[model samples]
Target: MMRVKHGSFNHVEVVEEMIFAINVGYKVNDLCTRCSTSQLSQSRRFPFLRPVRFLTDSRDVLWIMDTSEPQIDGPDPSPAVDHGLLAELESLRQSHQSLRSRSAEMEETLLLAQRQREDCVNEIANMSKIIESLCSERDRLASRVGELEELLKEKEDKFLSKFEEELIERESMRVEIEVYKKKFESVEEEMEERGGLLSRSMEAVQTVKDGLIKVIQNVDDDKIPETLGDENGGNGDLRLDSEFMPVFEQIMEVRKLVDLADSKVSEYKEMKGKEKRQLENSVVSLTEENRDISSLLRVALMEKEAVEKSLNKLKGNTEQKRVALLQFAERGLQRVGFGFMMGSGGSIEQPMVESYGASSTGSKSDGSECEEEVVSLASTVEKIMKNLRLEITQLRRCLDESRSDNERLESLTTKQAQQISENSLYIKELEERERLLAQNIEELLVDIKETETEVDRWREACELEVVAGKNEVEERDKVVTILQQELEKTKSALEISNGKLKLKADLAAAAMAAQATAEKSLQLADSRATGLRERIEELTRQLEEADSRERSGRRSIMRICWPWRAFIKVNAGNGAAPRFPNVRRMLPEMQSLLHSRV
Candidate 1:
């Protein structure tokens, strides 16, 4: 765009590189004093004898110029047409060099796009592998949770069945107590009926004996034999009576019955006492069993509820993640800029591009009109390329952001993994506590069964009139009660364990939620990476398409150049073609560069 010197040196050598001044009208936008600010005008100073046509190069720069000029000796003479042949040639050479530089710049832009596309492809492959591994790990965790739930249910069923058995044993003891009460009442009735008869008989016998003793006293020593005989007479008569003999035998039988009844009463008392002790023992056992086991069950229930809530939360998170993935897949290009630059670039192909043929056919006038049109087209291409470059930069920034998101997702995954491991450790501790509690309960139940059997034997012995110490049963009951205390302690421990398990489950759920979030982020990153890869692929396709278009455009320009080349050969004494601006030779290096990047 530098101003051409008015009086530079003469004898400037022209070496066939000329006539590129048509599209250079862009340089004169501010060069002319009377040039309209609203629209572009062309340079009229360049030497041209008639309407001439020039071809565009492979850079998509518009060509097919009409380079005709007004006669040198016009009414309005211009300083531009008065230049020596050498000076005109020198300016043309400069214009030709500038065009070469512009083509090179466009080629460099295409190669860079290719490199970026390759990098995007590499990144996507790595991210996909990471996502796959994470998915597998999540499946393993879900399996572990299911196994834990099944184990808990089994334990609960076993405990409930043992409790029911204890209840059944208590119901049998009640039936034995009722039978003892009825037998005790019959014994009381027999004692009252026999006692009254025995009292009357003793009084009559005493009166007879007293009368005999008084008669003996009156007879003194001589009457001693008669007194003795009188006493024996009544005794013999009374003894011979059927009623007396029966009365004597009835007294003996009543005494025997009373002795048996007394023994039976004593045995009943012992049995009743034993029953009372056992009832109290059962009461204590039931209370302990209810207290410890029930509390543990409540804790377990709470834990189960927490786990269920967690599962529900996890389900919600996963559902949300699925929805997000679906949305990303549908709108990934818009959301992640996969088609952002492409859309803008597509718009750059406006209707103004259609005016090239019309302008080329226009009547020649110092060639300024065509130069101005070419200049306008040049400016438009530059603007579009700038915009495209900016979009490429934006896409690059998005790729960087997605990478950062991936790094953050990795960090979150590690944190979640750590939390999961901690939850596992906590779960293991809870399982061990639960196991210990179960063992204690089983042992206590065995002790209770033994005590029950011992009590039954003690009651049997007392009923058979074989005396047995009550202390032994009492001691056994003490042992049973002690075992119950241990059972209670174990139950409390189990409750604590359940509570801990609940906390751990909650923590695990939180971790799983976080893991789900990380999974989503990873999925998003993966989608973004995939989008970048797709965009890059599209960009490469566009680049290849542009390359094909460039080749066709080059061929068209060469078609226009063919006649110009012949014209050059007729003027040149050497009879050979010029070598500058030959992009056909550059194609091999361009292909090699693309291959290296690929």
Candidate 2:
């Protein structure tokens, strides 16, 4: 038996082994496989999703337990279902509504996230601009800072260098002062010595004056009267009053001497006055030199004091600048200490060390540019130096070349001189030769004249001989006539003798020509033989060289063959050698051919 929990519940006991099937929120079929029971007809009931409420007898409301049938697991439906199925369906609808509400809330969240993303992107853009602006400011500040630093360093270096140079100059000036002081002291000593010399000369003049005064005082009145009478007295009176005359003359001479002494004293006084004037002039000159030196010293002292004051002022200024720079550096570093976003977060951050660093980088870039400019200047300077060096080298080379050319010209001049000398010598020789030739020519002319005279004489002799011959012929003719008169037969014998003489003269001329031809032929034969012998010698030398090469090659080949021959001989003893007798025999034939050619 089954008990129903709600009004919608239906239960039936089955005769067979019964099984209950519960499907919440689903209708049951008439035939349930698990339950052998009568089918509960649920189609007649209207489906409602209201909550099951039960009223107790006391009018108290009690909610009923939901007995909805389980949903079908597969395609099969449950056999029975109560109103619980409607309640389950209502609950599912409520859950779906709640899920929809959650989806809407998620969409709102997504929209808010997107808005925040846009704001963040905007903020990032602003920050980027701020950073860029800060970077620019930093670069500018750094550049300024770097420039200041460089200027400071340069000024300091200049000051130091100037100080060093001034110190060295001062040292040099001090040395010059010391030398001048020594010169001044030596001049002072010389002036003192000169003063002493002047004093001594004055004393010597005073002593000379004293001695002359004493000599004048010794003259007497008697001497003066005698000297006055001696002008009219003779030699005998002078001898009688010799003593008196001599004393008188001495007194007169003394008076003249006193006058001369007075003149000498005046002259000496004038000379001493002149000397005093010269000494005064020298003292004035010395005083001027001393005044000049004192003035120079005063000027030097003033300049030194001024320089010291200026140097102190400069030092103070430098110190002040240094302190100010240090304070600025410290203050700047402090103001730009590390921090997050500033009051103007999206705007720009205050520039600090980073700004200075950027500025320094910019300044460094400027410095690099300056360095490049300097480098270019240096390159130009180097080029100028190179040009100077090249010019120097060229000048030196030119000088050397000029020197060489000069030397060459000098050598050529010397050669020309030698050639001139040679030419002069040749001219002299030629002149001598000409003189000799002239002499020879003169001798030849004389010889020619003599020869001409001889020839004339010969001609005369020949003429005379002709005449004699003619006379002889005439005498012969006469004789013939006489003979003819005596004996006519002798005439034929004389004619025969004359014909023989003519034949002898013709034979002598032919013999002379034949001898000349013979000599010419002998000379031609000798020249031909000499030329042939030279050609033969040349051919022989070539042949010898060729033979030497051939012999050397043959020797090398023979040396190589010797080893092979020895091997062959040894192999032949072992009965392993090849024979070629004809090749060995051809060597002698080849030698014979070469010998025959030679």
Candidate 3:
């Protein structure tokens, strides 16, 4: 910086190296127009202030101070550097803002996914309830089928037992019938022999009657004696007499035979009574057996039909349960699929199970339904198995894809955060530069105020010296007047006596020397007053410069406070001045204080 005088004004101003000072015979164009930095040594002129840099380094030209006229142009940049680093900083700020917005969007999406997952869980619970109901219904149906089958089997057993009993009874009755036929034949044979004997006896009696009739007819009173004598043929003779005796014996024998026949007939009548009772008992027993067999047959036929119908119903229920399982099993798949049902479109049914594979039938196609036995059913079994390999593979693939997408997104977010953190560090350095500038300005203000107070004190001292010089001049004038009066008296006396003239002249010389010394003192006082006034004016100009620096710093304070207000408010109250300290040292203290308060 160089000083120059222009009119009565004295103050500092800034000038560019590109411009020349025509009045001062100085060419600034020779100085480096493309300044390497935005700061210079203002300390060369102002010793009270610490050296400091410009507000920012984006400018390419130099900082120049001129005490001549204030320059029109502001801190202008060099043509060589172009737009500098400002454009790059702007682009980074925009990208950081976008990353923050994207992170917010991701949070919202995650919330929606959580809601959908909850809904799926509720749906799964309801499905489990449905499955439980179906299982209970199936169990009930199976029990019913089992009961019907048992009833049918019991009926069959009863029918078989009764039928066997009836068969034994029929065989006994057939043997009895054969015995009766043989008895009838024997009785007929006896009757035929008796009839033959009776016929023979009748023939003999007829011959004897004919002989007796002839004897009676021929033997009137005259023939009677001769007939008797001749009939005895020798009845009168001894041989005749023996013949009549033999006839009497034969008559006795016939009487004995008739008595024997009477006893035999009584024995036969008792035997016939006993045989008739036995025949009646056999017939009654057979009729009772038939009735029982018929009743059992009717009951068995009813049970058979009931069993068939129950089996048909059980079959239908099995089909329904299988279908319900299929519907409930297909749903949102989870990882690994072990916690839930997973199956393909071809779901298992009861018919495919090993235990249930064989179909049931109570009758042959050509046989009577009434003769059929009960169908068999077993209740304690599960009958369906689903295959799930295909479905699980599909779910696994989807989960893999989703996991990959999430990993990539996380990596992108971390990179963006790193960039924003780097930018924040640069901003911290800029803040530090601004704090130094404020401190330098304050020191300059303090120095200017001190100088102004000193100038005032010096001017007062000069005014006092001038007043003393004026008093001396007035006393000298009084002394000179007195000396002149005395000289005139001496001259008058010399006329009376010429010898006193030399003494009066000596008094006059001493008064003239005092007056010249007083005039020189007045001249010295005027020069000192002029010098004090000039110093006061210089102090005033320096103060004006300090005021301008303060005003510019005030403008920056409004804008810069935005980033630091929270920090300032927490560390110091709003009424106090904001301080910028090295964050590393301050952080520990702030943390300790906050912890103590908490």
Highest TM-score: give the candidate number: 1
lDDT of each: 0.47, 0.43, 0.39
Ranking by lDDT: 1, 2, 3
Location of the lowest summed lDDT over 10 successive residues in candidate 2: 10-19
lDDT of 3 by residue, 1-598 (tens): 4332222221111111111121111112101111211221211222222221112122222333333542344344343332332443355346445444544544454455456445534533543453354345435434543553454355446545644664576566446545644544554454554343333233223333333334333322123222222222322333324323443334334334433433443454445446445434533543453354345434534543543454355345435544643443442122112232134112212212321223222112211221121010000001011223343355345444434533443343344334333433433333343344334434544543554354334334423332232233334444655776788898788676754555676677778888888988998999889999999999999999999999999988885544345665666664455344444555566656544553
- Model 2 over residues 77-160: C-alpha lDDT tens digits? 343443354565576556545544544554464456456546544644553454355345445534544554464456446545
Clash pairs, model 1 backbone = 50-68
Q: TM-score per candidate, in order?
A: 0.25, 0.20, 0.19
Residue 578's lDDT within candidate 3 is 39
**C-alpha RMSD of each candidate structure in angstroms:** 54.6, 53.4, 89.2
- Model 2, stretches more than 4 Å misplaced? 1-86, 187-598
Lowest-sum lDDT 10-residue window in model 1: 9-18
Q: Model 1, 58-124: lDDT tens per residue? A: 3333333344566475444355534543465577567676645644543464456456546544544
Point out the worst 10-residue segment of candidate 3 by lDDT: 374-383
